[model samples]
Target: MSSPTTPVRRRCTLVAPGSDERKIAKALESAADEVVLDLEDAVTSARKDEARALVCRTIRELRTGRSISVRVNGLGTEWARDDLRTVGALDGVGIVLPKVDTADDLITADRLLAELGSTARLQALVETPQGVRSIDEICSATGRLEAVVIGYADLGAALGRVGGYTAERWLHVQDRILIAARAAGIQAIDGPHLSILDDAGFRAAAQWTRDLGFDGKWVIHPGQIDATTEIFTPTSAAVEHARRVLDAMAEAETTGAGAAQLDGHMLDEAVAVAARRVLAQTGG
Candidate 1:
C-alpha cells in the first residue's frame, strides 16, 4: 500500500474541449481546482490534431495555479501515441488517460512521461468493464498515479444502461473504485452529472457521492463548478467541530484515556481520524 499523505484539495475539475480556446480560457479563469483540456470525446476526428496543438500551446502559456490536465485520446487510437509524446513533454501539465483497462496502460503512460522528462502526475479514467475490474492494479500501477476518475457515462453504456443516473446500478462500482483509490492513497473522483441544467439533481448527486467518501467531482460546465466545490468543501461549522474534536482527543490523551466524549457523542481514534481528514481538507 502507498504511504498515506494529506490529500490534495481538488473539489472541482472542469472539462473543456481542446478545440475551443474560448472555453479553455474561461476555464482557466474559473474557480475550478483543475481544468482538463479534452482531446477525446470532445473533439472530432478531423480536428484531433488541431485540438492537440491548441492544448499544448494553452498549457505552455496559461499561468493558472490550479492543475491543468490534458485528456488524451485512448490507447489503440491513431493519435494516442502522438498525444502522449507531445503533450506529455510540456511542463506543468498532467495527463488524464481515458479507457484505461489495466496496469500496463498506466505503466506505459508513466514510461512515456519519464522518457519525455515530464514530472506531471497521472489521472486514470476507469470507463470500461475491464477497467473497473482491474481498478486495483491500475491504482497501484505507478507512484505517479495521483487520481482515478470514474467515467460514469461510458461505464453506463458499457453496462447497457441508458439515460439516467441510477444509484442501484452504480453504487457497487463506485464503492469498488473508491476502495481501490483509498487503498493506494490516491484521489477518487466522481464523474460528471449530465443534467447540467438540473441544479437540484446535480446537488443531490454531488451530496450523495461526497457522503460516500469521494474526494472530488468533475464539472462539465462553469456553472457547475461553484456547486461542486461547495458540496465537496467542508463547511465552516464542520471545520470548527473538527477542531474541537481534535482538542478533546488531545485532552483525553493527556488524561491517559483511550477515548472521550465530545458533546454527547463518544469520540475515539476512528472519530479522530475522520475529524483530522475534515480539517485537512478544509486547510483548517
Candidate 2:
C-alpha cells in the first residue's frame, strides 16, 4: 500500500490541569485535536465554581477557537446542577460527564440540552464499577452521546484495583468500553498516562492506546501532542503502500481479475476496503 504526505488531526488532545481558562485557546492550537477545560479532578472543591464559570465563559466567548470539551463535576458533586446548566448553554461544547454509571445520567443531561436549545454533543467518562457493568446501556443513553472516554485514574480507585505502569490491569475494561463505543458508532478516547515528565513513557502509552483501537487519548501536557500525532497518523511509507494497493486493486478490477497482490501478499476485499478508507481519510 502507498502512503500519503498530507497531515491530518491526530487522535489526542491536551487538557489543562484545571479550567484555568487563561491559556486554553493557545494550547488547543499548540497541537491537539481537542482541548478539554476540566472542572473535575483538576479543580479543587473550593474552586469548582471558579472553574465552572471559566469553562462556561471560554465556551461562549472563545467560540472561534479549536475543539473545546468540558469534563464536568461527577454525579455526586454539589456543583453538577449549575455546571450542567451553565455549560449546556454554550453552542458546540462537547460535554464529558464524569463517573457515569447509568443511562439516566445521559438522559438527564440530554433533557437539559434540549430545554436549553443547545446542539452540543455528550461524551461519557465510564469510570465506575457500575459504569463498566452498564457499559452497553450507557452507550445507548442519548442521541447526544458521541464518545466514550476511559478515565482509568478514577476507575481503578473505584474498582479497588491497584494502578500499574503498562495498563495491563485495565485491558479488559478498555476492551469492553471500546466494544460499547463502536457499537454506538462513537469515538473512544483512552485515559491519560500519569507520568508527566517522561516523554518516552507517554509515547509508549499513546502507542499502547492506539494499538488498543482507541481513536484518541486523554493528554495532560503540550509535549504529548507530537507523540500523539506520531502514533495516530499513518507514516508516508504506509500511506504510499495504501495508495499502491488501491491502484493495483483498481487495475485488477479493470482486467476482471478476482483479486490482486501487493508485495507478494494476496489482497482481498477487506484489505482493499481498509486501504481505500485510509487513503480517502488522509487525502492520499
Candidate 3:
C-alpha cells in the first residue's frame, strides 16, 4: 500500500460545487483522477454551511476509487474552522486550503486535523503573491502537506494579468510553485484553464505545465479530464525507451562501466535516474 506521502497518480482533479448534489455525483462518476468537492469559490456566503454539510455527506456516501479532496474556505473565514472540524475526520478525504499565504496556515490546519483525530492529507493553494513568495516555507511546513496547487485565476488577478497568460508572463510564477513543491518532495499541480470550450488551448496549457514538471492539473469541467490525464501520464513510447535505458544501464554496470552509448546518445547515471522516474510514474 502507498503511504500518505506517496505521490498518487492524480492526473486530473475535477472541481465540483459542493452544494449541488447532482454535480457532485456526476463528478464522482467522471474520469477524473481526483474529485475536489469545492466549498470555497463554488459556494456563496449564504450557502456556506449548507455546502459544507452536503460535502461531508457526499464524501461519506461516495465510494469512488479516485482520490477525494475538499476545497475548504481560507483561514480567518467565518466557516473555515467548522469546515475543517466537520469534514476533517472523514477517512480518505483530503483538505485543500485555499489562499494559503504562510507556513503557519498549513501548520495550524495540520494541528487542527490532528486534534480532530483526522489523518486527512493537506494540499495548499498558492493563489496570492504572498502565497507564491511563501510557497517554499509552506511546502516544508508539515508532513501532511501532500501537494501544492497553483491557483492561476487568483494568482493572475493578484498579478494584474487576469485576461490570459502568455508563456512569458506566467512561466516564472508557475515554475516557482513547481520548484518549491518539488524541492520539498511534494506534488506540484497546475491551476485550471478557464477556456472550457477551447480544447486545443487547454491541451497546449497542459503540455506547457507538464514540460515545466507539474505532476497534474485541476480540471474545472469534466470534458477536460481525459485530455489532462493523457497529457500527465507517461506515453507508451517514452515508457518503452525508459525500460531500454534501464536495461542498458544494468548491462553496463556488470562490465564496471560508469556510462555507455545507447541509440547514438550517451547514457549515464543522470540518464538512468530520469529513466527510473519515468518507470516509477508508469508503475513499472
Q: Top model by lDDT, which number? A: 1
Candidate 3 lDDT:
0.85
lDDT of 3 by residue, 213-247 (tens): 88889988888888898898899999999999988
lDDT of 1 by residue, 1-284 (tens): 45244445678899999999999999899988888999999999999999999988877787556678899999879999899999878876788999999999999988888888877778999999999999999999998888999998888888998868766568999999999998887889999987665378888888989999988899888999988988999988989999999999899889998778888899987788789878767766
Q: What does candidate 3 score in Cα RMSD to the true structure? A: 2.7
lDDT of 2 at 91: 68
**TM-score ranking of the models:** 3, 1, 2
lDDT scores of the candidates, listed in order: 0.87, 0.76, 0.85
lDDT of 2: 0.76
Q: Estimate each model's TM-score.
A: 0.90, 0.82, 0.90
The alpha-carbon RMSD values of the candidates against the true structure, listed in the order shown, are: 2.4, 5.0, 2.7
Model 3 alpha-carbon drift over 4 Å, by segment = 1-4, 247-273
* Model 1 Cα shift for residue 91 (angstroms): 2.1
